[model samples]
Target: MIFIRKSNDRGRSQTKWLSSFHTFSFAGYYDPKFIEFGHLRVINEDTVQPGFGFEKHPHSNMEIISYVVEGSLEHRDSIGNGSVIKPGELQIMTAGTGIEHSEFNHSQMDLLHFLQIWIVPEKTNLTPSYQQITINKVLNQFVLIGSQNKQDGTVIIHQDVNLYVAFLTRNISIDYSLKANRKGWLQLVKGKIKLNNQTLLVGDGAAIQNEKINLQCIEDSELLFFDLSSN
Candidate 1:
């Protein structure tokens, strides 16, 4: 089964300094049927104005991932983790017991664009931690971004999930085999692609299950794919 979610169909919110689009029910957006998929809970695309960002906020029992798209984000957390996440960089934060964090645009003039993702951890009340890594080492193909095992040269997550990123160009095709009883989700960051005959454009997403993923690159594209245990 494959379910499509269009760009404009997402929950939208705009503030003086922030504009956000939510793929799943978040904050003030609630849809009984769209609360979550598998263990993947939230996918929020955010754009922050210069000199502006999120203030210290608390979260617990969730695995958070942040990927910068265009500009840089300055981060500081209760765990003493602080850094600037630039384009091609990713940040991982595990709010096991509880944690407070803040994020701001690292630039004084450039708008900061990024994606924030929240995944439900397999276990609760674990210790909190943080990590940030550059993704330049995983370009132009499907590269593991996060996994339960730590040997994949990627960030570790407390869940049965395999997250991947790929840069696809026209005339290229990538094939992915789905494990039994697992499901998938594809988030297209830019350009166009055709997944098993289903066409998707920039900012589009699809929920997939019980089938192979045949990715036909219709144009130069950047995307994220999640292979997750069935919900």
Candidate 2:
């Protein structure tokens, strides 16, 4: 089964320096029916103005992952990790016990656009950790962006989920076979695509519990897919 979450249906908030859309219940936008899907908790599409950002905040028992779509985000955390993440880079911070961090736009002129995702960790009170991976090598295939193990060529999270990003040219097609006991969430970041005969535009998403999926790029498209364990 596949359920569609239209882009316009997401909760939206706009500030002078920040514009954000929430896919699930987050902050002041509470919707009981849309609280969360499986272990996937939060998906926020954010655009930040120059010289603006999120101050140091605390989080616990949650795996936070950030994917930069445009511009750059400077990240600093209590775990002694600091870096500037640009497009095609993924950062994962496991706020196991407790951690404080800040994210700011690194560009002085260009606005920073990105996606922030949070997933419930499989185990709590493990340890606070951080990981960043450059995805320049996987521009051709569906690159693994997030995983639960450091052995993979991606950032490790304390969750039983896998995040993938694909950049496909116009008229290209990609087929994905879902695991027997796993589910999938597909989000179109830019351009247009057809997933199993269903057309999805930019910002649109679909939750798939089916056996397989066929994604056809109607236009040059950039998309993100999350494969989550059912257990």
Summarize candidate 2's per-residue lDDT along 32-136 as a digit string, tens digits. 878988899999999999979999999999999898999999999998999999997888888999999999999889999999999999988969988888885
Which TM-score value belongs to model 2? 0.96
Weakest 10 consecutive residues of candidate 1 by summed lDDT: 132-141
Q: Supply every candidate's count of residue pairs whose N, Cα or C atoms clash at under 3 angstroms.
A: 0, 0
Q: Which ranges in model 2 have alpha carbons more than 4 Å from their true place?
A: 137-140
Backbone clash pairs in model 2 (N, Cα, C under 3 Å; residues 3+ apart or in different chains), count: 0
For all candidates in order, the CA lDDT equals 0.91, 0.89
- After superposition, candidate 1 runs with Cα above 4 Å error: 136-140
Residue 107 Cα positional deviation in candidate 1, in Å, after optimal superposition: 0.8
Error of 2 at 139 (Å): 4.7
TM-score top scorer: 1
